[model samples]
Target chain A: MTGSLIILQPGHSVVTDLGRTKGPAYGLPVNGALDQFSAKAANILAGNADNDPLLELTALDFRMRATTDLLIAVTGAPLDLTVGGRESPQWEPVSVRAGEVVAVRGIRTGLRAYIAVHGSFTVPSLLGSCAPDTVVGFGLKLVEGFRLETRTTTAPITQPHFGLPLFRLGITKPAFTTNPVIDVTDGPDVAEFGDTAGLLFTTQYAVSPRSNHIGLRLGGALPERQLTSEVLSRGVPVGAIEVPSRDELLVLHRGRGVTAGYPVLAVVTSRSLDLLAQARPGHTVTFRRTTVAEATATHRTACLELERLRQTINTVFGLLGIGAGQRWYELSPASGA
Target chain B: MAATTTTTSQTTLDIYESGDAALRVVARSGDAETNWATVHSLAGWLAATGVEGIHGAVPTYDSVLVEFDPYLTSARQVRAFVLLGMRQLDFVGTTLREPRRFEVPVVYGGDYGPDLDRVAEHQGLDVEDVIARHTAKTYVIRCLGAPAGSPMMDGPDFPVPVPRLKDPRLSVPAGAVSVAGRQAVIAPAVAPGGWCVIGQTPLTVLDAAREPLVPYVPGDELRFYRIPAEDFGNFAGQFLEARP
Candidate 1:
C-alpha cells in the first residue's frame, strides 16, 4: 500500500521498532524502542501491532506533514504537540487530515518519545528490526527531506479515538514524576567490591550530559577502587551499571556494547530500566534495592498490563475493520533455531 | 552460588544471574580454546534443545553469555538445564572446525598507521620487523562488538605486547587494523578507540547491505598483506578472500 508522510523538520527522530533481541553473538544488542512501554502504547493508539515501527523522537521539537490522511499517536515522556497549529494531547490517538502538519516540541519531562502511525512504517530493516542503531548499521535517521512509507493504505481517520480508559486499565504509572527512584539489584561484582560496597545506593548520582544510547555516563562519588587492574572482558547486559577505575559510573542502555571491561556495580531492574532511559542529563537518580521476587512481580505486572492493552487494541481494531496486521515482530525470516 | 560443573585443568564451567532479566553461562574460563569449545558446544546443544525461554548465548574471549526470557525461565531452572548439557558435553570428542581464514590486503605504516613507528619503537623492533611479526600470525576473532561486526581479536600473544595509544584517535576509519595488549581489532565502522593503529584495509569489514554483512565472524581467522596506498581504490566491492 502506498501511504506517504513528508518530514518538515526532523528533530533527531529515527524509525524504530521492538529492537533486535537475538544477535549478541553477531555483536548486536537487543536494540528496540528505548522506552518500550511507551512504544507499545503508541502502537495501540495508532491501531498498529505491538511491534510495529514508530518514530523514536529524542528531545522532541519535530515537525512532519501528513501527506496522506493517517491515524497517529504520540506517547512517552510528555511533549508539547500541535496538529495543524492546534494544541494536541498525547497518550491518545490523533487523526490528521492530508496536508496537515503534526508537530512536537518542548520536551519537558523525558528524553525520548514514540510517535507511531496507524499501520506501521515500512522502513528497511537490518536483521528484521527497523530500529536505527548508531552502533550496528541499520535503517536511516530521519532528516528534513526524507519520506516514510506506510505498510497500510491511507484511509482518512474519521473517528475521535477515546482510548483513555484502555490506557488507564493498562500500564501502571511510574512512581517518580520528576526524579526516578529506579530499582536496581546487585551486579555480578557485588561480592568482590569489598567493604565500602553499598556505594551505588548510598551515594547520590546525577545523569551527566555525556550520556548517549550506548550508556549513561554518570558523575558521582567515585566508588573506592578495590582492585587496581581490569577484569576479563565479557558480555555486558542492557542495564549493567559498569564502574571504571574512578568516579564515572556507566549504566549500559539498550545500545550497550556487546562486551564490557569494567566491574559492574548494579543492574537496573527490567521495568525501571525504561525510567532510566528517560533520565535525561541533570536528572537526579536514587537507587532502591529490590529482591528478584519483587522485580519479577513488577515485570509480570507490566507485561500482563501490556497484554491487556494489546487485547483491548485487538478489539478496537476489529471494530474499526483493520484486521490484525502481519507479523513484523519476528526478527528474521529464518525460523527460530 | 551457580553450580560449578565439569572442571578442566585450566578452567571450570559456572553460571551467573546477570541482572534479573537473563542468565550467563561461563562454559570455560581463562583459556581461549576451552572457552571457544564450551561456547560452541553449549550453543549447539541449546539450539538443538529449543527450550522455550533459552534465547541463546553470545560468546566472548573466555565465556558465552546466555540471555533468556526471565518470565519463561528463572536462573535456577536455566542452571539445571545447563548442568544437563554439561554432562553431555564431550569435550574430548568435540571437533574444532578448521577455521575459515581470510587474507585481507592492507596498506601499512603511513598516515593510515600513524602509531606504527611508535609501536615499533616501544617493542624494540624496526618498522619492517613490527610489520613482519604482525603479519606472521593468523588472528582469531575473539569477540564481535562496537557498532556490530567489529572483531576483537586474539592471536599468539605478541612476544612484545603492543601498547595502546595514550590518547586514542577521535575516529578510526572503518577497516583500520589496530592492536593493544596482544589483541587486535578491525574497526567495522568509524568510531573512537584506544587500540594503536597498525594499518588500514580497503576491504569492507562491515557493509550492512553485504550478503554476509561482515567479511569475517567470531572464531574465524584473518591475516593481513601489505598493499600500496594507491592500490586501495583499485580494489572495489568485496576484497580477495581466502577460506580454510
Candidate 2:
C-alpha cells in the first residue's frame, strides 16, 4: 500500500509495532504497543501481520483521512469509531474510500486504542521498529497536519460492483472493564517485602494521574519492606511491580528502561498486561496471585487463539478468490471492467 | 520462585525468573567489579551464540536480564540457555573483544555545566579542584541505561560520593555528563534525569541513523578532557569515536 494518511485531528498517537527486540542490550527500552493483544487483533483484521506497524492512539480525540482506498480496523478501548460521519463498529475490517475520514473519540472505558491499515505505516525504524520512545525523543514524532504514508499499491476503489463483495470478520467485542482484577506472579524479591507483600492483593489501587508509557504509579496502600536496604541497580522486566522506599507501588510498563534500582515484589502476568494497558487514570485495579506455570499456559492459549484466527482469515479470503497476499481492494476490477 | 544456579569454573551464575517472559542471571558471589565483568561476559556470549527465541540480553552491574518469547521459549528453557552461555563464557574469560578507549572533550562550569559549582561546594572544594579530580582518572564503561545509549562509566576519583539532584530536571540536554554516588554517565539523548550534571560534551553520543549506533561497548575506556566553552559550536553533532 503506497498512499498517505492525513491527520485531521491529532491525538497522543504514535506508530507502534513489536518494538526493537535487540536494542535493550544498548539501554533502549522496548517501546511497542502497550496492549499487544488489541494491536495484533487490529492488524489481523486489516489483513496485515501481527507485528505490522500501526497507529497506537492514546485517549484524546483522533481523526485521520486516507488518500487511497484502504482496509482499516480499530481495536482496544471501547471507543466510538465514526467513518465518514457515520457510526462504525470497532474490531472489524471496514473499507474506506479515498478522502473518507475516520475519527475515534469518547474513549471512556479505557485509555488506548489501536488503528491498523491494510499495510504497515512507513516510518523511520531505529533498531528495526517504528515505535517512538518519548523519553529519549527517538523515532517519528507524529503531529497534526502530518501525512503518514503506507505500503498500499492499490488505487481507490470508487466503483461499486455486485461481483466484488467485501466481507468483514465476525468477532466478539472485547470487554473493557474500568475496574479489573489483574493476575500477578511473585517476583524474585517478593520474600524481602515480608508480610506487607500480602497487602498488594487485598488493597485496591487507583491508577495515578502521573502514569505514562514508562510506568503506572498506582495510588493505594503501599507495600512495606522488612529490609530497608537499597536494591542493586540491575535489569528489570516490564510489568514488574516495584516497591520504592516510600509512596505507592510503581508498575513498569513497555517503555520502562532496561535496568532499575527499586525492589520488585510481583510481576503482572503476560496475559493480564494486555488488560492493564487499557487502565486509565482513576481506574481501580486489584491484583490476584497466580503461579508462573498458570500464567504461562494462559499466554500460550492466547497466542494459539490468535494463530487460529489468522488461519481462518486467510482461508476465508482465499475462498473468495482474493489470491494469497492480495488485498480486498486488488480484486479483479469490477465485473463490467 | 525457584532460583537455579550453574557453577562454571570460578564464576557462579544464578538464574532467577524475573517474569514468565524474562529471566535474570546474577553473579552469586563476587565483588562489584568482578560481578560486572562476569555479567557482561555472559551478555556478549549470548549475543554471539544467537540462541533461539532470545529477544534481548541486557547487562547491568551484576546481572543480565534475558528476555524471550514465552510462547516459543519456556522459563526453564531460558534458564538452560543462560547456563549454557555461562559455561561458554568461562572458556572465553571476560574479554570478548579488545577494549577501546575514547578521549571525550567536555566543557565544564557555565551554561554547559550548571551543577559544577554545586558538586564542588557539596564536596568542600573549588570548582577547578573538582574538575581536576574528575579528569585525573580513566574510567571504564560499566553499562548503559536510562535515556537510551547513555554510557554509565566507573566513577571518578572523588573523595566523597556526589549526591543526585533532590528534584530531577524535566529535561536534561543531550551530551550532559552527569554523576551520582560513585557512578558517572553521559546523557546520550534529551530526557528527564536526576544526576548531577557537571559538564557537557558536544559530540553526538548516539544516533540511530548511524551504523553501530553507540560507538563504545561495555568494556570501553573513557577519559574526559577540558575544552574551552567557545569551542562548543565548532564540534556540534560530531560523532564520538574511539582512539584509532
Candidate 3:
C-alpha cells in the first residue's frame, strides 16, 4: 500500500546550521545529534530502524505540517512541543490531525532533541546514512522553506501505554546539572606521558564552551608531555583525547579531524560516548580507567539489553493483535484465558 | 678521550591496548621509514594469515591499529596474535608494493595558491623553481582517506620542513594542494585547513556519486602537472569521467 506523506518545514533550529566545512582556519566541528542512542530509540518507536532519518533539533524552532495522521515520537533533550497551540510531552508518541502544524520551541533542558516519524524522511541519502555528517556537508540541514517528505503510516496510531520515563531505559533525561563524569581507557600514546599524567586524568576537568563534536578543548591543568616531537599523523577514532601541547587537551569525537599530530592520552569507550556528547560548556568531567575486559563486557551487555528491548516491543504489539500503527491508549493487556 | 660506540637492541613489536575495541602495534625505534615498512609488512601478514575476529587493520606512519569486534575477540587475544605475527614476519618480506604513478594537474599561484610565494620564499627559491622542484619529485601516498579523500603524499625533500599556518583559514577551497612538514596533500573538498597551499589540483580525489569514491590508494605515486587556471573546468570534468 502506498503510505501517506507529511510535509515538514524546518524552523530556526541549530541542527540546521552546524557542521564541518573547509575554510576559516581550524576544522569545522560536526555538531548534530548529541545523543545518538536516544535518537535511534526514537526511530525504533516509530517502527523504523535505528539508523533512519530523524529531525535533530538543537534548542531551535522546528515546524511540521501533517499531511495525514503521523505516528511520531520526540526523544532526546526536553523541548516544548505545541500542536495547535497546546503543551505536549517530549517523549511519547503524539497524534496530530491532518494539516495541523506542529512546532518545537527552545529546549527548556538538555542540549539536543530528536523527532522521528514513521517511514523514510524523504531526503537525499549520502554515504548510506540519512544522518548528516556535518564534518562533511552530506545530509539535509533543516532550513526555512525546505520541505521534507515523510511517509505517513496507515497503521493505527498507537500512543505509548507504558508511562515509564524514557531515561529509565538508558536514555538521557533532561537535567540541570552539566558536569558529567565520562569513563575512558588509556590511549595508545598514553605511555608518552609519565605516571603523573595518568593521575592527572583522574582529576576533574572543566569542559570549555569551545567544545564541539570534532573534539573537546578541555580546560584543566595541562598534562605533561614527555615526547614533545611531532607524532606521525595517524587515523583517529571518536573519543580520543589527544594532547597536542602542554596547555590543551583535545578530546576527539565522531566528527574529529581525520589526522592529528598530538599524542592521545585516553579514549572514551562506546557505552559512555553518549554521555560525552551531551557534555556542555563549563561541565566538569572526570575520567576513570577500566580494564579492557570491563569495557568490552559493558559494551556487550548494553547491546544485548537493547536487543531485548526491541523484542519486548514486538511482543507487546503482537499480543495486542494491533499492528504498530494502531493507536490505542488503553493500558489493559491483550485478553487471554 | 676514548671513542666508544653503543648499540641498543629492542623488541621490534610493542603491543598496547587502544581502549577496548582495538590494540596498537608500535615499533620501538622512532625511524619513520622503518616504522612505516614494519607496519605495512605486519598488516599484509595479518591479512594473509586470516586472523579471526579482526574487523580491519589500518597502518599509519609509525603504528598499525587493528580494530576487532569486542564481542568476538578479546584485546588480550588480539595482542597475542599480533605478537605471534611479529615473530613470523621474517617469512614475509617487508617491502610494500610499487607505487602507481599518476599525473595530477595543478593551477599554481594567484588565488588558487596564495601561499605559493611564501612557500617559495621559505625555501629561498623562485616560485617557478618551487613548482619545478615539486613537480620533479615523485611522492609516495601514505594514506588517502582524509576529508574528501585528501592524498597524504610524502615529500618535497626541503632542507627545512614547513610548519602549518599559524592562523588557518576557515574555508580552504577544494583541490587545494598543500604542504606541511614533510608531507603534501590535495584537499578533495572545501574544508578548513592550516597547511600552506602551494597549488590547486584539478582532480577531485573524492566523489561520492562515483564508484571507487576515492581515486588514489596507498602506495600510489603522484607527480603534479602545472596547468593554467583556464583549463581547470576541463581537467576537472575529465578527471571525474576517468573514475569508474
Candidate 4:
C-alpha cells in the first residue's frame, strides 16, 4: 500500500537505518541511528524490521501529519508526544487516522527520538543501505514540508501499549534521566596515555554545544602524556575518545570519520555508546573504566535482553509484512560476530 | 587489556582490544621497508584469512585497525589469530605488489593552480621546471586521509621541502592536486587546505557512486601529465558528481 507522511514543521529529521557496517572500508563512516537500541525498539514496535528506515528526529520540535491511516511507534527520548492534540504514550504502538497530526515537542531530556512506521520509506539507497549520511552523501536529508513516502501494508491497529523497561548502560530503566554514567575500555592507544589515563576517569567532562553526530566534543582536563614523537595517522573507531594536542577531547560517534590523527585514550563501551547517543549538549559525563571481559559480559547481556525484548515487541505489535528481501535484520551484537 | 604478546622476533605485533567490539593489530616498531607497504600488506593478508568476527581491517601507514565481534570472537582469540597471521605474513613475505596506475591529466599554473607560482618561487625554481620535476615519475597512494578519498602519495624527488601555504584557502575545489613535504595529495572535495597547489586535475578521483567508487585505493599509483586548461573540458571526470 502507498501512504505518506507530510512534515508540518520539520525540526532536524533524517531518514536513517541501522546504517552500513560493510561500507566503512570504502572510506565511509558507519552512519546510522545514534541511539541504535531505541531506534530498533521503535522499529520493532511499529511492526518493521529493526533496520527499517526511520525518521530520526534530532531536534525537539518535530511535527508531522498522516496523509493516510498509519501504524507508527515512537521511541527514544520521551518528549511531548501528541496525536491529533491528544497525549500519546512513548515506547508503544499507536494508530493515527488520515489527516491526524502527530507532533514531538522540545526534547525533555535526550538528544534524539525515533519515529518508525510499519513500513519502509520509499527513499533512495546507497551502498546497500538507506541511512542518511551527510559525510558520504547517501539518501535524503529532510527539511520543512518534506514528505516521507512509504511502502507498507496495513498493520493491525492496536490500543495504546507500553514497551518493556528502557535499555541503557547495560540496565533497564523505568525512566531515563539526563547525564547518565558511561563505561569505557582501553583503546588501541591507551598505553600512550600512561599515567595520564587516570585523568580520563577522575575528571568530568561536559558535552560542548559544538558536538554533533560526527563527534561529541568534551570540555575537560587534558590527559597527560609523555611528549613522544608524532604517531602516524590511523583508523579510529566509534566511541574512541581522541585527544588532540591542545583542543578538547572528542568522542567519535556513529557519524565519526573512518580514521583520524589524534591518539585515543579510551573507548566508550558499546552499551554505553547507546547512552552516549542520548547525551544532550551541556550534559556532564564521567568515564568509568571497564576491562574487556567486563565490557563483553555487559554487551552480551544487553544484546540478549534487547533481542528478547524485540521478539516480545514483535509479538505484541505483530510482525511487518516484509518479504524475503527484507525479512530479517542482521543484529550481530559484536559487529557480525 | 593485557600486555602485548609478540609472535615473531623480527618485529613485535601489538594486538589489543580497541573498543568493545574490535581488536587492533599494530606492528609496534617501524619496518625496515619504506612507505608502510609491510603494514598495509599485513592488513590485507589478515583480511584474507577469513577469521571469525574480524569485520574489516583499516590500515594506516604502520597499523591495521581490526574490528572484531566480541560475541563470536574474544579479544584474546582475535589477538592470537592476528599474531599468527603476522607470523604467516613473515613466512610468505609481503611482496610489494604492482599498483594500478592512472595517468591524471592536470592543468598546471595560472588561475587553475593558484599556488603553482608560489610553490615554484618557494623552491627557487622556474614554474615550468617545477612542473617537469613533479610529472617525472608515478607516485604511490599511501593512504586516503585528511579528507575523504584524498589520496596522500609519495612526492617527486626534490632538493628541498615544499613550503605549505602561509594561510589555508577557504574553498579548495575538488581535483586540486597539491604537494608538501615528501608527499602529494589530490583534494577530493571543496575544503579548506594549506597544501601548495601545483595543479588542478580534471579527473574525478573520489566519487561515491563510481563503479570502483574511489579512483585510488591504498597501494595504487597516480601519475600527473600536463594538459591545456581548455583540454580539461574534454574529460567526463570533470562533470562526475555523486547522485544521492
Candidate 5:
C-alpha cells in the first residue's frame, strides 16, 4: 500500500540569502545545508538509497502534511519539532498520523537540519539531481505556501534506531584552536604563483563573511604571483581554491561557475567538502597538503562506512520480522502481529 | 624519465592527475583547431569507454575535466582507463553542430553603453566604425556558465582589446553587452560587472521562468543589431508579457 504525502512549497523567502561581493569584486557563493551529514544518514536509516532526495531545512521554515503514515528520522542541526503546534523531541522517530502537520523550527547548534522521509520525496529532476542548485534556481526551494507532492506508501511507522557513525570511522571534528586544515593539489596556472606564495597557503586563514555556495573567501596574507596578467576563463568546480588577486583565496562550492580565469591554489578533498559547506561567516579554516594516495584512501573509507550504515539498518528491520512487503510493522518487540 | 608508450596506437597521450579524484589528458596540440579537436575526440572516446565512477566529462577549448567519485574508482585506475580510451579515438575533426542563432537587437551608446565613446577613442575608430566592427562579426559562443547563460564570445580581433574598469560598477543592467580583453559577453541577469559596456541587447538571455532557462548554448552564434532606446523598451515589454 502506497500513499501520497504533500509537503508545503516554500514561499518567496530564500533560506540562505546571497552574500556581498568583495575586492576584485568577486561574488561569494552562499553554500550551506541544514544537516549535511545527517541528511545523508537519514536516507540510509530509512532504507533508501544513499543519493535519495531529502528535505533540507535551515532554522525551521518548513512544514509537511502526512498523507500516509510513514517512518521518518530527523538528523543534523536540532530543530524544534511540532505536530499541529505541539512540541516534540529532536533526533528521534515519531509517529505522525495522516493529515497531521509536521512543523520544524531552527536550533542554535547548527543553521541547517535534515528530514528524511521513509520513501523518496516527489520532485522534478534538474541537471540529473533533485538537490536544489540554489544559485542556478534549478530545484525547488521550500518556502511558505509552496506545495510539494510525495509518493504515498502505507508503511507502518517502523523507526530503525541508528547512531552517529563518525566515531567508528576515526573521524573527529578539528579543534577550533587549530587552524582549519584543507588538503589541495596543484591546479592549472599553479606555476603562475611564486614559490613564496605557494608556501603562504600553508599558513592559517579565516573564512570571511563573503562566503557562499559559489565559493568561500579566505582571509589571509595575500600570496604573491609571478605573472600578474589575466588568465583566459575556464571551467571551475567545487573546492577549486582560486586566488583571483592578492590577499584572498576563493574556495569554490557546489554551485561554482563552470568556468573561471582565477589561479587556483588547491583543490579540497571530498571528505572536507561538507565541512566547508557548513562553515559560518568569519569561521577559521586552515589548509594542509595531503598525498594523492592518502586522499583516495580517505574517500574510499568514507564511502564504505556510508554503505555499511545502510546495511545495518536493513539488518535491524529484517530481524524484527519487518519485510519489505509488509504494509506496516510494529515498533515494539512482539511475537507475530 | 622514460616516455610511456601507448599499446593500441602510437598516438602519444600524456596523463597527469589533477587531484585524487580527477585526471587530465594532455594531447600534443598547440593550435586552437588541434586543441579543441583533441578535446572533443577525447571526450567522445571517454563517453564510449563506459569508465566506471566517472560522473561526467566537460570538454573545454584545450582540456577536458573528468568528474568522478574517488570512492568508486581510484585516480590511478581512471588515468589508465583514459589513456587506453584515448588510443581508440579515431582522430577526426568533426564540425560541431550549429546552435540556435539569435539576432540580438541593441541600443548602443548613451545610457545603455556609457563607455562607447571611450572604446571608440581608444581604438581611434569613429563611433560608427566601432559599432560596425562589433555588429558585423558573427561571434562564436565559447562558454555560457557564468551568471546563468552569459555567453563568452570571441570578439573580432580588434586592434586593441578594451580593459575592464579598475573598480567595477555596483550593478550592470540585464542584457548589457560589454567587452573586456578580447572577449564580448552579455549580462544575463542584472548584477555587478567589470566589463566595458558598449551596448544593450533587448533579448532576454536568461529567464529562469522560461522552458530552456538559458537562451544560448556553447557553439551558438550571436549577432547584435542596433535599435532605438524606445524600440528596445517596446520589445522587452512584449517579451516579458509573453511569459506565463
Candidate 6:
C-alpha cells in the first residue's frame, strides 16, 4: 500500500475528494466527486476515510498496475472490472497482489466510475481537497505513465473472501434509468420564470453532447423568460437549472463556477443531484417540482440510510479483524445531510 | 440610539430559497450603490455570527447567497436566523468598516492591451484620452466571482457603456484589465472572458498561500495608474497589495 499505482492507460481520470468546503467566499468553485454517494461508498469499502482522494474514471477503459498488496473498491457506474485478467466484483472490496494489473473497462451504464484504494492517493491538495478546478487552474490530471503514491505500508485485508460469516452490504447504485424523473425545488428566480417553469417538467430533455463536469446542457425545451431584464452576476449553487438567453437549458453541477448570470428556473434536490451525476449524453430526463421541506426530508432519509450502512460496516470489519476502516471512522465521523 | 432609529424604513429584505441547503437574500429600498454596500455588510455580519450549520456567505451586487448544511439546520431555521441577525446588525454604525484602498499598476495599449485601439475607436477618443478617463475615478469593488480573485468593480465614469466582445477570447491573460457596461475588472487568472481587455497588470492577484487569497475584499476602493511597458515585466510575480 505504500508503493505507487502506475497508470498504464489513463482514460479521463483525475483525483477527487470532498473538494473545497470553504472557498466559495473567494469565488472558488467546489469541484468534488459528482456522485457523492458512490465516492463515499467506494472509500468505505476500501478501508479509507469517506472523503479520501480517489481516482474518478469516465467512459473509456482504464488500466493501472499496483506495486504493493492493496485492497481497492470500484463503484459508481457498472463496468467490466478485472485483476490480472480475472473477473472481479465491483462495489465490493477486492484484494490485489503487488505487480497485478487491474482493468476497468466497458462502462455499460452511467457516466463515471470510482477507484478507491485502501491507503488513499497521495497528491497535492489545495483548499483541503485534491479535486481539480479547471477555472482556477490547479490539481493533478491523471496521464499515461503517471504514478500515484500511497501512504499506508500494510493492507487492511489480505483476502477478498473470509471464513467467518461473510457479509455484504447492498448499496443503492447511483445509476440513471432509461428516463429518470428527478425532483427539484424552486430556484431563486423561480418567480421571475412565470408560466415558463411548467415547460421544464412537461418536456423530456435529452442531455446534450456538450455536457461535462461544469454542467449538463439539455437540448429539448428551453424555458422562455418572462423577465427580459438582464440579471446581475450572482452566486450559483450546484444543481441549479439555469435558463440562458439562447441555446439549451443548463443544469449547473459541482464543477460550476461560484457565480453565473443566467436566471435559474429550479434547483435539483440533493439526492437527485447524485442521480444526475450518472446522466450521460443522449439520456432522456424529466424534472418534477417539489417543495424545499420535502426535498430536505428526502435527503435526510438518504443520509440516515448511509449512516446505518456505515455502522454495519464497522461491526463487520471489526469481526473480520480489519482495524484500518474503524480507525478512520473514529478519527473523522461522516458529515452530510 | 442612532443605529436603532436609522433602521426604520431604510431597507427591505427578501429571502429566496435556493434548493434545500442554500438561501438567497436580496436587499432593496436604497439606490443601486448603497444596496451593494448593504449586501457586503450583511454578508460579513452573517458569517461572523456563529449560527450553527451556516457554511459560507457569498456576496454579489445586491444579494447574498448563504450556503448551509441541510441536515444540521433547515432552511426555515436559517431564514429565521438571518432575519434576526439583520435586525441586530447596525447598518448605520460600526458594522460597516472603512473601505481599503489599493492602486493597481497597468500597462495600456500595444501588445499588453489587445483591444485598446478598438475601444478607443468605438468611443471616438484618442488612446491617451481613454487611459486618462479610465484612471480618473476611484472604483469600488462590488463583488468577486469566477476566475479566482477578479474583483467585479463599478466606477470610471465613462460617457457611455462599453459593450462586451461579440466573441469572447479563449484565454485572456492573467491580470488583464477589462471593462463592460461601465464596470471594470482585473483578471486574476487567465480565463475566458467577453469583456474587452484594454490593459494588463503584472501584479499577481491570487496566491493560495496568502490569507484571504486576494489583496482587496469586496467594498474596497481601487484606483488604476499607468505604468510603462518596461516596468510591467519588472513587477512580475509581485502581489497586488492594499495601500498600507
Which has the greatest DockQ? 2
The DockQ value obtained for model 4 is 0.49
Q: List, residue by residue over A1-337, the lDDT tens digit for candidate 5.
A: 5555556743222322111111001111223342345556666665565566676664446677787765565655555777545565444444456777777765434445666666666766543345554445556666555655545453444232331221122222222222345676665445667685566556677778777656778888766667768666655545777777666778887667655777665677766665665666666777777666887887677667667766666656555443352232434556774
Q: What is the lDDT of residue A297 in candidate 2?
A: 97
Could you tell me the lDDT of residue A90 within candidate 4? Answer: 79
Error of 4 at A92 (Å): 1.1
Task: Indicate which candidate wins on lDDT.
Answer: 2
Over B1-244, each residue of candidate 5 has an lDDT whose tens digit, in order, gives 1123343333345555556655555455446756565665666566566567775555555566666768788777777777656655544334455466777788999999998998888889999999999999988776554665577788755799888889999888888999988889888777768889999887766665554456554566778888988887677543322211
How accurate locally is residue A17 in candidate 6, as Cα lDDT from 0 to 100? 91
Q: Predict model 2's lDDT versus the native.
A: 0.83
User: Candidate 4 on A62-159: residue-level lDDT in tens?
Assistant: 89988887878788887888887777777766677778899899786788899998776887777667876664455786777788897864433534
| TM of each candidate vs. truth | 0.90, 0.94, 0.81, 0.86, 0.79, 0.92
Residue B90 CA displacement from its true place in model 6, Å:
3.8
> Can you tell me which runs of candidate 3 are displaced by over 4 Å?
A2-33, A82-87, A151-176, A195-199, A245-247, A320-337, B1-11, B27-34, B37-55, B68-99, B233-236, B240-244
Candidate 5 segments exceeding 4 Å error: A1-37, A59-70, A77-94, A98-111, A134-136, A153-180, A197-201, A318-337, B1-16, B24-28, B44-51, B93-95, B98-102, B169-173, B207-217, B233-244
Question: List-wise, what DockQ does each model earn?
Answer: 0.51, 0.70, 0.31, 0.49, 0.33, 0.47
Across B1-244, the per-residue lDDT of candidate 1 in tens digits comes to 3234656444578676677776566755766687776776676677678889777666676566777766787666777887776666755444446678888888887988888898888887788888887788888776676657677777334567776677877878888888888678788788778888889888877767754467665667888778989998877776535564
TM-score ranking, high to low: 2, 6, 1, 4, 3, 5
Model 5 chain A — which ten-residue stretch has the worst lDDT? A17-26
* Candidate 1 interface RMSD value: 2.2
For model 1, which pairs clash?
Answer: A19-A31, A19-A32, A135-B147
Q: How good is the docking of model 3, by CAPRI class?
A: acceptable
For candidate 6, give the lDDT of residue B131. 96
Per-residue lDDT tens digits for candidate 6, residues A136-170, read 66788788889899876344344445422123567
lDDT (10s digit) by residue, model 2, range A228-311: 765667888999998764777899989998888877789898888888899999999999999888989999988887887777
* Tens digit of per-residue lDDT, candidate 6, span B60-179: 987888888788899889888877767766444325678899999999988889999988888888889999999998988888888785799884667778888999889898889998
Model 2 lDDT tens row, B1-244: 7577778785777778787889888897667878888888888888888888888888988888889889998888888778777776677677747889999999998989999999999989999999998898898888887778778877888879888799989999989998888889898888889999999999988877764478988888999999999999999768899999
DockQ head-to-head 3 vs 4, winner: 4
